[model samples]
Target: MTTTSARRAPSGSVSGRARDFRLYWVAGGVNLLGSQASGLVLPLVALAVSGSPAAAGLVGGLGLTGRLVTAPVAGVLADRLPRKAMMVTALLVAAAAMTVVAGVLAAGAATFGVLAGAAFVQGVAQAGYESAGAGAIRRVLPADDQRALARLEARNHAMQIAGPMIGGSLYQLARWAPFLADVVSYVVAAACVAAIRTDLSPQRAERPSFLADLRTGLRFVWTHPFLRFVTFWAAGVNFVFGALIYHTILVTGRRGDLPVSIGLILAIASVGGLVGALAAPKVLQRVRPVVAIPVASWVTVGLVAALPVARQPWSYGLLFGLVFLLTPMVAIVFQARAITVTPDHLQGRVATVIGTTGEALRVLAPVLAGVLVARYAPGVAALIFALLLAVLAAYATANVRKLRATVPAVEED
Candidate 1:
């Protein structure tokens, strides 16, 4: 493996790349805001129409299912096509879908089926856009921009806070408003992506069959112990975290808490992620992954164990926030490492496989948590999740030291 700096364009002439990246950043933030807004609005719309919480969950599940199904195909296209063009096309498709949905809502003609179908389409577009956008980032920026990557992730966290609030408020005012807003955002994001001057198409000598490309990605991850370990660890942690979040929601709702209060608590927890993202690059500069990964894992274990005791809203929020604070830091380090190690031609496939693996269990976690909460106490569910986290922590503690020693040194820009 070669250093990124060795392959990069002259360091002195970074103004063009910097400008292009800034545009890409703005585009990503806009797209994320729209996606998050739609996420909130879709379920609420379903709940309103069907008058059943279960129906709302089904609508959300359909969206995730769409993403899961499309991810592998999206990964292959992202590697073969021009990333900027793919991103623009995806944004346009999403915008068109949302616009039609908005029109349906405005006319009071939307049913659960219609909404679910639209959500699925939007999800597919979102998956493609994200996969291609990641490839675009790799093409436009120098690989060693760790701080820049951290900042991008931090901005994403900030949008997660703002998007829901804006979406919820808009949904309250009028059902069509949130969808309309998302349509506008998609258009703006498309324009931003189109304006980037860098040619973001993959440089390939020959294209392989789609199935062959997908298998290559899977094989690479399977053969690399570090990639395999991190992917599984990420999946396990995400599963537990998803369950914990659902458990919190169940507990709060059962207590007859106000919806606004629950939203506020969750939003407060996201602030911790925002802070962690800002701190990640500096922290990674000082600490090695071997030390940081295990320490963070054990800390998370302690926090999950303590969750059973915190009953009040503020106390619960604080503890939840603290537990999530480590997430962004660890994610930043892991993503930086993954990008550094992966070949340029395989970036799209590798990123997709890793991302898909991490998210595959998340859709099931909420349902499992709800079942557990209904059958047992919330504390019992928390205990089970804590035990799961503890197992993952132990695995990391045993394996990370060897993995860290084997990692190739990839120099920063």
Candidate 2:
């Protein structure tokens, strides 16, 4: 396997690389806040205009469709173009789109069609930004500082909690309020990208066709046993976990017997994820990935297995929260290991490929969950998904152990 070592900055009070990473991190946080806000606001806007829950759902689905369609192409561009430039352009475009949407809504001229179109554009821009941003991190951070990377991942998870709350609160003030906030965030994110001094363009001798480049990324993941195992394992877990969450919300709404708010339930889970991310580096310091990931997976299986029987809002939230608490720790170890081994030239494509695999079932899973809940009981749906997760977790644990036994320690390090 070919690995790219991190390039160190010249000696000084603070390295240019370190400064640039800080700037990039700020940019990501700002952009995430905006994106999360828009994610909530856009669907609400659609529902306001059309007065149809299904229509609102369609608007959200269309955004995901845009992301899914453009992800591969965005990945290719991230590898071919300058990473900072790609991020800046994507942010600028997103800012402009959000600005227009905000203006239209403020003017009382917004329509469902217009909102959906803007959402799709924003989604496409987000895909490019995320692809380039991943490459930028690899370029700026020292490969050996896995703890730093884990911290950044944790911060991003924290934003997941903060962003939506900010958005929801602003949305209550006015429909346009959250969108205007997003517009400002995108502009600030663009500025942060512009401020990054370190050059993050791909350094390759010759470029291949887009198809070939895409295939190269796929082949790399497929051939690497650990990456392959993690990819499929993550995909399965993501799918089942997604279904479980959706089923919880759906069943709760249908039953109307919950003592707590669904939003609170989700917030608790998000908070748990943030805590997990924050604690991951410390946990990984004591336990290696070979040991940590499988243990977490099995623990996740036990937590999920109990979800079917827990119908009370607090009980469900506690179980899901515990499940989410383990997620980021496992994720950080896998991601840090993957980034350490992946070459810089392949970073963008490889990151995107893994992201695509992880997200492949996101849209489908909710739909499947709804069907399952409708066909049988919510408990039945939860149990079935839990079983699927357990099976996947077992498979992943075996593969991780086998890979650890076969691979050299230095490769993982």
Candidate 3:
């Protein structure tokens, strides 16, 4: 297995890296706030527009579609082109989409078609931005900096905790508000990407065919055992977990529940995730991912098994919160491993391959959850998905029992 050697970063290096990352982090936080607000309302908008659970599924699925279709190409470009330029372009595309949609909403047209179009466009842009995301970090931080990785995940968890509450409040006031926030965020993100003094361009010596480069990435991951397992395992979990989220939202929304109540439920889950993020470096120090991941997976089984008894959305939220608590450690473990294990030139491709594959099943998750929850009792649907996740978890645990992970020590923030 390829690995980045452990090292103590010089104090000057640490300070430089920290200074650079702060700007990027600020931009990402701005982006996350908008995405969270929009994420909360987009499906509700769909459900309101068409009054069909399936339409909600379709609109949500379309966003994933845009991501899946462009991810591989985005990865290649991230490796060949200037990452900052690509990110700026992506931000512009997303901002334009949100701007147009908000304008339509202001004009009082709540059409499903326009919302779907905007979702797809935004998703495409998101994929492009993500393809460059980790590569950008590699430019500033050492690959082996586990604490920095944990901090990155922590920011996401923090945003997750805050986003729904803010989104819910804004949604209560006006639907157009969140989309307008998205436009402003994109501009901020673009400026941040452009302002970074670091050279954030690919440094490859040769240009290969797109297909060849893609195949090389695929081949590398396929040859690795742990990455291979995570690729499929994550997909199944996403499908099941995604079902639960959409099912809860759709069922509750159909019952005339207010957005704030739903946001609180989502925020509760983020609270757990935030705790886990805060503890990730400590957890990773003591526990092997091989143990942590599978244990978390089984714990998830127990949670899902109890889902049948969750009578209210808040009850479901608590159980799901526990599930998310296990996520940040496991999530940081895998991503940090990926960053340290893969070579710099290959980071964009390998990261994207893993990312693109991980999310592919998510497209179907909302649709499947929508259909199942709409057609069957909540308990029965929950049980069915629970059993499905149990199998995937068990399989992943067995395959990875012998594998190991290596992460570097924490750096001063």
Candidate 4:
């Protein structure tokens, strides 16, 4: 295996490599559809079954909790397990969880506890899939193909517009329809993994001691200034973003017969994200990650903060467009940074840590956001969160010295 610096690719090298990336993109797309479907369906289900917006909030919060709780363990397993197998299992488990939720809804026994439990399991499944899938990208393409990776990220953003609209439309017909459809998409995603051409083999076939493996991954993160800074900034931004996810959905969904309204906002936001995601590689080629990331974060921070004060379509629309463009860019740049810094053998663990830490903040943020919204207006919380994000963005940019010089340096063991 090569070293990270050994794989440093010229920016112009990504052309003519579309075929390899397309296969991986297809699988990602399948999962993306399922994710988008579930995103809308889960909240709707909780709202319908529990008859309270708080129940939906709890369910969503628990999912992030599951992700945060499972990430460390999943990180270790990602290094030891076969990537495809891990992803397939994650998809299957998620499918089963959704299936159970669907059945409970069908049976009219979908209590808050049941929804929370299902969400927790689904979150764990998502944790595993994310850790494995991020690592698996190396198996699918060479270093120079990162632009393709950016495109996949873009495609996912695009689906945010398409998937939720479809899911929400379907939800209007049968509340359970979205969940059932989500299950089938998972099945397809699993099959796609099984069909990938890469050899199915774990990198650490002997399975190093779990504690030892975890320590190594953590040590890399701690010792590396770049990872440290990025993780901190990402955690902060993710915390706020997580809150928005819950707040926006809750505010829109519970307001009235506004599923379409929610979908429309999401679709418009997706358009902005789609543009950002698709253009990320090109943007990064011209601008450094340090500059790009802080700009994006600040954009999100400002927009989300104004979410509460903004009266109607005008302010909300502008906020949505601003955050939409910036958020996806944040995600893309983060992936690019991770792909650069992580050693290939530790990709799974690195991914796990990244997902976990971000989600840990996310988990707490939503619960707090909900509580605050319940007490004060959602606007107040949004303002506070936005202000915090502004501080975080400033800190990130000020500390750019720690990460700006850090280029990608990954390799398979």
Each model's number of backbone clashes?
Answer: 0, 0, 0, 4
Q: Which candidate would rank higher by lDDT, 1 or 3?
A: 1
Q: Which regions of candidate 3 deviate over 4 angstroms? A: 1-12, 43-60, 107-116, 142-144, 171-175, 250-262, 311-313, 370-380, 401-413
**TM-score of candidate 2 against the unseen true structure:** 0.92
Candidate 2 lDDT over residue span 1-413, tens digit each: 23444333232334776787778888999899888877877888899899999999988887788778889998888888998899999999989888988999999999988888888998899899989987767767744466667668777877887888899899999999999999999999999989888778876656777887788777777777777777887787778888888888888888885534787778788878878877888888899878888889888888877887775777788888898999888777777767666666677887888888778777678898789978987666767877887898789777775444233221111
**Local lDDT at 179 for model 2:** 90
Error of 4 at 312 (Å): 2.6
What lDDT, from 0 to 1, does candidate 4 have? 0.73
Write model 3 residue lDDT over 148-254, tens digit each, in one string: 77777788889777776677787888888888887898899888877777777765567777887777677767766766776776677777777778887887787
lDDT (10s digit) by residue, model 4, range 106-181: 7877787888898999989988888888777765665644476678868888777678777878788877788888
Q: Rate the local accuracy (lDDT) of all candidates.
A: 0.81, 0.79, 0.77, 0.73
Compared with the true structure, model 4 gives a TM-score of 0.81
Judging by lDDT against the true structure, name the best candidate.
1
Instruction: Please give me the total number of clashing residue pairs in predicted model 3.
Output: 0
1-413 per-residue lDDT for model 1 (tens digits): 22322133222347778888889989999988987887888888899999999999888888888888998999889989988899999999999989988999999998998888888998899899988977666656654477888789888989999998889899889999999999999999999999988888865556667887788778777776777777887888888888888888888898899877677668778988888888877887899878888898889888888887886788888888888788777777677666656656567777888889878988778888889878987777777888899999898788775454243332211
**TM-score of model 3 relative to the true fold?**
0.84
Q: Worst 10-residue stretch by lDDT in candidate 4? A: 8-17
